[model samples]
Target: MCKDKIAVVLVTFNRLDKLKQAVEYYEQQTYPIQEVVIVDNHSTDGTIQYLKEWVNGKGNFKRKTVLLNENCGGAGGFGAGMDEVLDEVRRHELDADWVAVADDDAFPRKNSFEKIIDYYKSLSDKEQEDISVLCSRVVNCGKTHINHRNRIKQSILRARFMAVPEEEYDKDAFDIDIFSYVGTFIKVNALQKVGTTNRDLFIYGDDQEHSLRLRKVGRMQCVPSSVYDHDRPGLGERKIGWHSYYDSRNHVYILKKYFPIQCLIMRCIKRYILDMSVFSSNTQQERKLFKTAYMDGIKGNLGKNSVYKPGFEITDRKD
Candidate 1:
């Protein structure tokens, strides 16, 4: 271990069991997490009480929890958690060299963090300084690579990014243009240089936006040795439902953030045409929501959970 303070920001909403599992995995990390900053998006599933118990339980780890007044989604949760770390650094209460963001359903192996830090330790000072984000290989439940690394399509007319195929993953550390937040360990200084995660995004595509913005700061690497299991279905395995709105809306905002309006419109058209079958499967209300997302997205209206909001009360499964 390099003795650099690392803060793991775990964001959760109504997933108490998965949250507990995530905390346990972090606790078991060989490199030892210096601090764990958990942002509860008003889980309302008895997660608060469980977190209280976990905090009070016997452990050598330093942990902090933030219960937001509202459900800010993953983007806002991470933004808030990182803001907490930055505030501590400002107040001279803590010195965080890196901040790792993880979801409630992601569980990193015990040596994953150690391997990530070891890679940094092996780097020369100049190399280390130029490195921005260190990402992990995300494998699905079936132990298959999830193609987490994203690269922007090299076209003037296209405003989208493409994921490298699983067969192409070489199982070695390599540079990438964008990465997801599931097991992303970002340098604190790099985050400071490129601003913070966009809280306005609320959820889907926020990681891509943040990672793309980080390209100006330093290089991003995906370390295959640092593996984590993301308990999520394969891409396109499930029909777009609750997240369709966010995904639909954020897709435009993200494209517009990176490309010109004309290119963005072109990409949107291509995507809309290709996804017509998926859209047709959606119910009337879902189609309406999708249309609203499309209209709001094209207009560059990136608001919070005002249009469609999830439950924030203390309900186990009433949502």
Candidate 2:
């Protein structure tokens, strides 16, 4: 036997083809999933209708779907997905011990679930109970994706809290301060304590924020043996859209909420350099987007920006 039952919470927006592929990968997992909650972020594509038709009391796992009224971005969609899973548990439909986070475009390898389950079995009882999040090594385009684990910088003076050195992934299991939502396993107990992911973020920095909170409740580990693949093609309207705004805004929100005052003070001088280096853009619309985002972030104004919808161009026109 299986001592643990895992559920998956996946959120998608208009990527029906990728969603189908991800579902196929999930079906191939050696370790069985008890339930799967998929949130469709009001895709203009036929995703909602397809999901409705596809989930007809078939497949090895119990399926649940949440169709949103608006496109709530990854952050909101994930929170909604978690809510659906919790609702199913309340209804006694399933008892899920672990919640695996995933996206439409990314998926675990064939033996990914088996590897994670094996690692979980190897841990001591105390360690197993104390582990809040378990992350798998993720690769994209033959390169090690560092988002699986982020080692903390561990200093109040540092503006940023993480340093993602790819070399740190050689260990069988390593302690990590943060784990990305993609390809990570979270304990239901931790969710009961720390709460579901922050939906107010609406897009970016949501994973890091949730990870930091979960760290306070229990240990997070990255198991190199468990690997997943995340190959997000850097194209489409999503590439040219409002992510830059969310990136700048959510970064500031994270800094204010988690960083020490000493770090905040240090960031004062480095903020401009940071912006120019990472967020700098020549387009008039892009510059304005950054400025507006930075302002809202500092003022604690968050959530989906009314003007900056994904796949839509942000223009300088006042009318």
Candidate 3:
């Protein structure tokens, strides 16, 4: 028997197709889920209306689509959705033993939930209780194969994108030292003890901050047996325009909030050196964008109204 009733909280902005596919994958999970909550980030593209219609047609799942009046970035949307879930769990109104946080663009494997549940059962009671945050191996969505070695190399590079090396990627359970919000399964009790995601982050680094806090309370693990296909397309080429701005500014916020002064100093130095090397090989436009992002990183300027943009809409339904 499944000891935990899972609540899958998905946050989406304008990705309607991806969201629908992700929900379809969720419906196929072997392990039972209590509910699926779709927190709409005020998308203007009729996403809310679509979800409303979809949820209306599906009566088997206790699905909820929350429409935020404003478009809070991913960080704020997730925190708010988590707050709602935790409140319901606390009141015993919702039978949620675990809160699974996933991106709308990702799809879990058919046996992903079963694998996670089995791993949970295998652990000692103490270990089970202590394991608050659990993550699954994420593979490229479009690609059918998993590149374990490349993932390991990416992790070692400490590149802006966090990825596990292909060789280190195992299809088994293991403890994780870092916290990843995307496609992570969190214990309800552990989340309550550690607190929710920081809304101040407003965009990036929020997961890392929350994970750091979770480590203090219980164990975090990467379950290789539980895998999900991340729907992000392969990086055929680099597009470093607005992305550079956010990436640079987010790192600064992370360092300021979590890292010690010396550590932050060393990080900045390393990043500067790396940025210079990267820019040396890139086009003029790419170099310019990277330079802008790097400067913004130093100034800690995340941009104006980065939390929400205009033309965004909110809805109460899944459509």
Candidate 4:
């Protein structure tokens, strides 16, 4: 097994049980990770205390965990943790070959890191240098199949039209130029060259934006061998409350930043038409939220106070 030290950074808000499961999986990995940094986003629950106790229970790995104060959103937490890692690298306090960003709700297979190390080692120096981000195939918990459409859409949006077809997706592990932050293992130097997560995004679209920037520096690969189980529902079922706000606002934000106004208009038109076609058979609330969010997104008032604002904080179960 390659003994390359890796800095595993995780961000969590609540979901202590899910976070514990993720950490447990990390502890069972075949390859060695140098350190684990958990950033708690001001959970009103005793998540921090629970994590500290769990770390203490792990004999050798106990000393490897570090907890941070403050509830920076996922994007901000990643930026802060990466900054710490880079500082440690600069001071020679750490000599990690890679940095893995893991979501608190995600768990990788036991041999996931082993596979990553082997795949990384197989690459030539030039190929490694040219690689920006290395991503894994993520399966939702309890599901056997992959969501190819979601993966394709995410990859294309991140690459900003630099993506290739599925046939050309992987050319001997040297393919496309996009990746997701969740369950991703990135080269340290590549991140340094491309810069860290955009704190402004707070949460959504930050990964896509960072991956897009990384393309300017090097290539990104989606490794099918390294698999992780993400404990999140499908986007369609998961869409509710503030998730709608972030999704709609960020879509508009991305369009405004990267596309022409005419393109944005066309995209909005296409989106609503598709929604109307598909959602017409769905329940009234689903249709209402979908329409409202889409209209607010196109009007560039997605994040502003409106009728949609009241629904932003309502849990999906209640809605």
Candidate 5:
């Protein structure tokens, strides 16, 4: 064993059972996880109490938590969790080299941590110098690769980001432009340099945005052998709801941040006129929400929307 210390961090709202399962899963990993940081977004359920009790015993991993007063969404929860790890490291409380930012419902397989570390250790010292983020191949329960890894596509006049195809998951090791928070393992030093996920983003696009920042620091390798199972369903289709707002708002921020020229002209003209309104958003209400989203993004007003919100509270049974 390389004996490098790692910490796993995840965000949870009120799904106590799922949270417990996630922690147990991480504990079951072949490679030891030194600590688990649970960021609770003000769960009304007995999550805080559960964690207090969960940490009391003969567990393989030490448990830590960040209990928020209000729901800051996944982006804020994750950012806080990673920042907590970084702070712990700075304080010499957490002797960790890497931190895995994951969702409450997603985690790497039992051997995943071991495989990922082994692959990293296999690389020559020179090869390892350029690699800072080691991402896992995230897959849904269907045993198909989720749209986890992606290569960015953008230019002065246009921008597009699509995940690499399922076949690409077969590659043992390959570089990618982006990785998801579902199971992305990041080097603590690299995260410190790039900073944590944008808290303003609140939810959607936070992972992608943070991944872009991490990419600038060093190479990100996608190792399918380090398989991650995301216990979720396939995204069916767009439903007109609170999520529509965040999806609309953060997208413009990403476009404007990365492709400024394109965002200036294209997002204002093309996306605003076509993709956002006339077609994508069907109802007048949907259009209104999207319009607010676009305006917020344009004015650099990013954060949890006062009107638009996340619909995750009534969560549990695979819906």
Candidate 6:
């Protein structure tokens, strides 16, 4: 028997088209979701209208939307969404035993949630007691694609730990130290203990930090039977553009919070070398932003985003 109903919280910004596709896919889940809570990070691209219309047109599942006033990035969006659902659960208004986190571009396989529930139900009570989060095998949306960004193999060196690669998808489920938010299944009990995602990190590495925080209370694993397709291409060495600031800054916070001193030092050296090596046409601007992120991170200054762009915040649902 399923002990608790599943609630999914998805965070979205300006990607209305992708978000629409994701919602349609989720609405068709074979196992059926109890509720879907969407956190819109102030989207100006008529996402609010789309969601309102979708909710009105669909009556099979409970849907809720939270409209933020500004662009809080993925970290803040997830934090806000999770806290809202947790509040409903605490108030006895929503009987959600497990909460799943997803990106707006993540489309799950029809049987994915079913597979997760089955694997979770197969675990012994003692085994279940030790597990906190269950991650899904995430792959690119096209044929013959391997997604290295979704999985990780823990190591002393930050480079090794952060970018652990799996060449292909596996059929078995196993424990893992790190994962992304593409399709992260977390237990309500664990949240009650470890708390929610960090809102301050704002964007990059927040998922990593949250996973580490969850580890302090329980274990995490990847359920290979469950899978999702992310509407993203395989990534290479990314240029330091607008994304570089958050990537550089939040990484520092993650290292400071979790890594040992020796590991931290080695990671710093390796990271510095890699950062310095990756330069393109906009090398000077990239270097300046990178240095700024590094210094801010070192100072532990996690203020509001100085570089974030907000989306439109509005309501179309009159009810």
Best candidate, TM-score: 5
Local error of candidate 4 at residue 189 (angstroms): 1.1
TM-score of every candidate relative to the true structure: 0.87, 0.89, 0.79, 0.75, 0.91, 0.86
C-alpha lDDT values of all predictions: 0.79, 0.81, 0.70, 0.66, 0.80, 0.76
lDDT of 2 by residue, 266-299 (tens): 6644655554344544355555666677778888
**lDDT by residue (tens digit), candidate 4, 36-85:** 77777777678878876766665324234445555556777788777778
Steric overlap count per candidate? 0, 0, 22, 1, 0, 3
For 116-180, candidate 1 gives per-residue lDDT tens digits of 98888888888887888988888887674555787777676765577766664565677888888
Better of 3 and 5 by TM-score: 5
Judged by whole-model lDDT over C-alpha atoms, candidate 5 comes out at: 0.80
Which one wins by TM-score: 3 or 4?
3
Cα lDDT of model 6 by residue, 1-319, tens digit = 2384789999998899899899888888988788899999999999988877766666557888888998888889999989988999999988888899998988998999998888888888888778888878776755423332344444666433444346334546766676778888998888888888899988877888888888778888777678888888657775445567777788886777676656567766665665543532235445456666777777788846556323211123121
In candidate 6, residue 126 scores what lDDT? 87
Residues 174-248, candidate 3: write the lDDT tens digits. Answer: 555554556688888887887888775566666766776787888777777787888777677544444455556
Cα lDDT of candidate 3 equals 0.70
Q: Candidate 1, clashing residue pairs?
A: none
By summed lDDT, which 10 consecutive residues of candidate 3 come out lowest?
148-157
Q: Is candidate 1 or candidate 3 better by TM-score?
A: 1
- What would the C-alpha RMSD of candidate 3 be, to one decimal place? 7.1
Where in model 3 is the C-alpha error above 4 Å? 141-163, 236-239, 270-319
Full ranking by TM-score: 5, 2, 1, 6, 3, 4
Query: Which of candidates 4 and 6 reaches a greater TM-score?
Result: 6
